[model samples]
Target chain A: MPSRASEQVINLIEAGLRDGSLKAGSRIPGERTLCMECGVGRSSVREGLRVLEAFGIIRSSAGTGPDAGSFIASEPQEGFSRAMAMHLLVRSFNVADTIEFRELVEGWSAAQAAHCEDSAQRDAALAEAAALLDRMDDPKINQETFHDLDMQFHTLISALGGNAVVDTTLGALRSSVLGYVLAAVKQLPDWRAEVEILQKEHRLLLAAVHNRDSAEAQRIAVQHIRGFAERAKIGLQQ
Target chain B: MPSRASEQVINLIEAGLRDGSLKAGSRIPGERTLCMECGVGRSSVREGLRVLEAFGIIRSSAGTGPDAGSFIASEPQEGFSRAMAMHLLVRSFNVADTIEFRELVEGWSAAQAAHCEDSAQRDAALAEAAALLDRMDDPKINQETFHDLDMQFHTLISALGGNAVVDTTLGALRSSVLGYVLAAVKQLPDWRAEVEILQKEHRLLLAAVHNRDSAEAQRIAVQHIRGFAERAKIGLQQ
Candidate 1:
């Protein structure tokens, strides 16, 4: 019941990451090895690995060989997204606030993409957004898949925004809001009208970017967000 | 060695919060009581309380008898900030990215404040920002305290942006950048010159907000951020 062993293990692993003692993709010692090295019970070592895995900081595979132990994970974005989602859920944050935050970050991202200090990344993002809009016309696309594509389109713009921190924060926030968004959509009797409105707004927003009109882009983005939130019927509590 | 007790405790408390078993400002049972209730050892109970306290989910005051036990803490912001700071440190994030992220959020916030339909909040924010700028002229104000005031000014704008997610994220990011910003400023041989430049930009940005010109406010705010990043000799990490 004394869990001090677990905390020490976590501290050790974190220290390893910070000091560059454990690089991405490096394998951690086996459970037995950790038990011996850290002088904790094997059960405690396993528990520490479980915590790391839950945090998306490590990956585990079972086998009898030497390579069957835990390994450091390189998917930083996954860890970030999960951490953010858990925090949002635990806090019972307002969904409207999340949407508004997205509007701000994504608006700047769109503006930056339009300016295209580098033409290639800008063109790629614009093309991706356009492609997503084209796919939105398909009646066969399930709501779930369509939502995933929608996320990609937005993520592309954020990636092109030329700000890693903004991109990461917005990406995580968007993912966290997915449940609220889907629940809102499921409640609607007719999503066609809602989808159409958003599509038109997206087209205009993309055009605004193509024209390097930052003001128009920002305005359209905010309006688009507000419209979606309204459609979702999420109140202040969400 | 069985740290599952800690995880069990976390799950129980989170469930309590979700299911309304625990309300804000309510007192939790003492260690002995929790141990009996949770079917775990006292040490395990204490460890769980430590983790919860670390996350600001609960608070414990040291005393004996009636007032010494744990009480559920209602404030989520402290936990959010602590998680954010730890996340950044673990990621070994670059300072430039954090500044750029702050700029994007704050720029959007300034623009939102300018275009806010709620004029009262806008006016209040403007007054706060103006007060900070006015104080910049006082030679008696030390840089450290002034930096904190400057944070409050920007924080006021984020709050006025009408988004809790944005406000919290920007606030946490701003706090994370404080160490690096102060270090950079201290490195400058002629620090007053940099302060003057930032002050002029701040006044101009506030003027834009005062005029309710969202576009100008956004532009000035973004430029102010970029300019400061440059003065600090930090690269955007292309």
Candidate 2:
């Protein structure tokens, strides 16, 4: 429900973006300047800037120096994650749909990783994933640490697919439900046992990708994800 | 880059959302009340509210009437689409990656539609898709009209998968690159011929789904998408 004046400001900025006049790191005009350019009041300009900042399309600072004021930004992940979490909170989309979507993307990513053409790059990625797994193996670490590493492992596997859209969307999805996931883990009857099983599945998934078995990698990816959701009774409410 | 006070406001609202106190359509406190609650100034409260509105977590109206205050909202699609488009503008993710991601999701959705257990719902969706195709086949339609129907057709197929996340994300992705897609269509050397080819593919795709040929449905979905991108030389820069 942005005002018409604010919408004009947004439209002007979007036009600049599409025509290449604006770019990441480019400085945006101040409120006064934008008000004149967009033919809107200062309040409208500020409102439009706030919307842009919330979307991570721009970053702003307050000072009288050269570095102050708004600049174009490319950090959409934070905004996307926050917005998605809010959407989930409002029940616009349910957990089961999210789990299903994640399964498809993550499974496809794993399969693609298994079939990667560059052996050197693929091996390096696998090695990085292995390192993450080793960290998860440390029994003294807290559940939060384990969960953080777990997300990194899955994100790394998706990154190996070399699709930025998949990588970003998957990362956002993981972060959106992070609190629910952590709470579910804490509620588990035997956290240690469940961790062990998750670790084992991770190892098998890595091995499938390492051995270039695309089908097996995909199958394991789907099973590992759905199994955890089922075990935690996370998305069953839908 | 929200100020500390604004961050507090966002955190408080998020907590309310998590605890079920801030359901959709619930009216948010006014700016002065929020400022006092979050121990911030009026500006900070407005900033926080703007961020929430940009995320589509809330909507506000002018005046002091009962319905004039901010209310929790669930319209995340507009914000998500705008952010994604801006991300694409800044080259955070390229067109090729978006196209690839779409192929994966849409192809899987088509296959799901083909294998759908509920024949009545499946047939209804397929008939809807067919109706869209019929509109696209109209010889007098403009490119914009044709493009709109084309997107609707793809979106409907994805909806048949019954995954809300997929539906929303696919719809956002389509909207995010809409201008670029339309421009590409206009640039085609033989627009009518290309349209004819796309129509044939659409008809065949619908037929495959109707026949419950999951494999063929998926195959056609991918080919139709990739084929158009290739023909238009779109997303070839990567």
Candidate 3:
């Protein structure tokens, strides 16, 4: 259970946010001020602030200058990913469920991207994804770099789908399972062959989206995800 | 920025989790012990522990007893919902995007529930949902109770879909938008009539799932969500 003092501090900050008194980049009160306002000691205030920081809702600076003290912020994707990764580590969630959820969301996102009404935005995202594919084609690229680019490519496609919630959820899911994914890659006997197959699938997915073939894009997205999981044996149920 | 000491403590705990040294319900080291082990002060250790508690990974009990100190736990749903709610309050995500995402996920869940392979599990979930609907039919119940039941009904459907990730995501999304939803209810001039319409829709959705009508379940799920949002004016694009 959290200390009552810390809860008080958290409640105060949350109230400030709900009332629009604290906007992004708005510097919050110092520890002393928070303590006085919330009737709590400095340690409790600090603890509450740390909790908020862990949630990526605030940023703190070291100095007493203009850029000092804690400020309200919004970086929920990092916090979401971190929380998800921790849960996965503790076995609170399993890899199979995560992959299943990812496949569904990514499939929907791909279809939506293909059906995107804004041609300019859709084309821009496709170009960015193409560039990521081009980077992945470099033979000298390591597994980690290739994986990072791969995640970025998928995230870009989801962003083009015009749903921020889906994009964030997919990004966090990818990050949560990243360790297992990388380990699986390392275990593969033919890494080059696997990469070659993945590159081909990526090209097909991109082309489908570029041509506004919603059905094909969705089909490829689901197939590609399930194929990788099967090949790497990341989330297979016994 | 979190203090370096707190970060050190957090890293230590995460490492323990990753290495299988920590399991759910296992008691973690005390603050003094953590301070010594992590080379940090007691305050830093407490701050880090507080952060973990905020993430729903640990629970602390007061006093010196068998269950006194913090114990590892798995309650990511609470943490996810809290983080999402805070982000929503800060305008990091708008209601429109959330509703759109919920529609997609819930529709998928309803279809999956209808197509569930395990008849026993599917029937059990449908029975639970029917019970919730019965409770919602209480004419004297307040809007709050009805809304809570409504959310549980939807969450149960998602669970029946057999994806924990989707279940948690939908729960968090519903909670993130709960305040606005309740406020919209307060604004309705004919709350009773609205409740009647919602109850009818819920019955139809439950029947569709119970009958294994996947197409009808999916269609009703999407329509119900969009219809509620339209009627409540919760996420309208002004």
Model 3 stretches astray by more than 4 angstroms = A118-123, B117-124
| C-alpha lDDT score of every prediction, in listed order | 0.71, 0.85, 0.85
Higher-scoring candidate on TM-score, 1 or 2: 2
* Best model per TM-score: 3
What pairs collide in candidate 2? Answer: none
Evaluation by DockQ, superior candidate among 2 and 3: 2
TM-score of each: 0.69, 0.94, 0.94
Q: Write the per-residue lDDT of candidate 1 for residues A194-231, one digit (tens) a residue.
A: 77787788789888878878778778877887778876
Q: Give the range where candidate 2 chain A is weakest over 10 consecutive residues by summed lDDT.
A: A74-83
How do the candidates rank by TM-score, highest first? 3, 2, 1
* Runs with alpha carbons beyond 4 Å of true place in candidate 2: A117-124, B117-124
What CAPRI class is candidate 1?
incorrect
For residues B1-238, could you state the per-residue lDDT of candidate 2 as single tens digits?
A: 5668788898888988888898878888878888888999888888888888777778888887777988888565666666677777777778999999989988988898788776687778888999999888888999999988998998888788778888888888888777778989888999999999999999988898888899999999999989999999889866
Q: What is the C-alpha RMSD of each candidate to the true structure, in Å?
A: 6.2, 2.1, 2.0
State the lDDT of candidate 2 residue by residue for A59-134, as single tens digits: 8878889899898885656766666777777767788888888899989999988887876877788899999999
Candidate 3 per-residue lDDT, tens place, A106-145, comes to 9999998888886776777888899999999999999999
**Which of the numbered candidates is closest to the native, going by highest DockQ?**
2
True contacts kept of each: 0.20, 0.63, 0.59
